[model samples]
Target: MSAFGTLLWLEFRKQGTFAMGMLMVVAGWSLLLRQFFAWGAEPSIVALAVVASTLMLAGAVVTAYLLWLGLDFAREYRNGRWALLLGAPQPGWLHLSARLLFACGVLTLFAAGMWGTLAFWLGRVGLEWPLGLGLALWAYGLGGVALVVPVLFIGLLVAAYLPARADLLAFLVGLLGLGQLLEWSLRLFSAQFYRWLPPWGLPLPRLGEMAWEGFPGLPSEAFVLLVLLCVLLFSAMSRLWQEVEV
Candidate 1:
């Protein structure tokens, strides 16, 4: 395998089990949801149940992945693997990229799966959600998930460099500060910068009376700004990664 591939494999070897377990739990929840749907007498009620359940699932998955992402590097500090990675010839970005890619890939799978699952359940109830809308939602969700990776990675690095026990507090504080900065930056984008950029609208299939006509699209600059912000955060993370002792 190539060096990047090797790093990806190493990440899998470290956290693959947890990822698999998480997937299984989601699968089990899907089955349970199916069973619950079968119990609903009203079509509208069952459809509402499906929508609410899907949202709940999405929120749970996001939260779980957040913890998982933070732990990806934090766990290494305790398990003696940190020394091995510090000794490797790979650059710090390679290591960070591998984890970021892995985590993002997992969430992508999750979003796709949930979208398909909702389509299936909704089909059974004679309601159809648009593919365009699903894709839009998936992109929006995955973007949120992917963007936080840099913050979490930096938090892990901060925690690792601190004394034990105290590290937890340091990590949370770092995340809070970074998160606040991100919020402020986004506010600025919304207040002034967003208007300067073109609107990136979603194209929905016209289903006659069922078509959505008035949903405003997001500014293209919102996405560009997010990408730039993540790049900045990841760059800072790379610099901090080298400071961790072997």
Candidate 2:
């Protein structure tokens, strides 16, 4: 197998297990909530739960990605594997691309599993399955870049700069989680304001809400702006990664 292929497998092997464990946890909580709470049967409530749970699951995946990348890179650097790889004929972008592909694949699985679970629950509730599923996945995909970019920036910084990989990963994860908590708190105060910010605060899809009604669907101008923002983020991340110390 190629080096990239081997790296991908190792990443999947580690992350797939975590994804399975997350699935079980989400399933158990969903089942329990359905059995105990009448509110869980309400479409809006259930949809919100689904969204929140999926977001949390996605966050867990991001956390895992950051942790693994940080640790793996740190180990490689410590053991001089990084130097070996650099000495090889392989391009720097190849290593970076392999890592990016691993991240995208893992994140896609997490997003798919969450949307699938949401579809099943919506089906049980007699809601329109396709719309619900489509909206769930589309919104998650659109919003994912915001979260991924920040996580990537922090992860690379920690991996390449920090002397203590474990401590840095722990601190970064805690900081990310804290940011989410603050976002949730702010949303409780005013969702409109939250929608104006990045990460959790950005406007994404609304399953039943119509775009013409000026809901979470981005306006034409804002959509263009968001695309630009994504481009800028990608460029910035690429530059940072290139400059990252071993």
**Lowest summed lDDT window (length 10), candidate 1:** 203-212
lDDT, candidate 2, 1-246, per-residue tens: 997787677667755676566567656655754542365456666766665765666566556655665566567767877546555555555566666666666556556665666666655644444554454454455455455555554555554555555756755774686477546645553645445555322334344652225335433333434455555555765665666555
For model 1, name the residue pairs that clash: none
User: Which runs of model 2 end up more than 4 angstroms from their true locations?
Assistant: 13-16, 23-33, 36-75, 78-80, 129-216, 219-246
Each model's TM-score?
0.76, 0.52
Evaluated at residue 189, the lDDT of candidate 1 is: 88
Task: Tally clashing residue pairs in candidate 2.
Answer: 0
Reference-based TM-score, model 2: 0.52
Clashes of each: 0, 0
- Provide the lDDT at 206 for model 2: 45
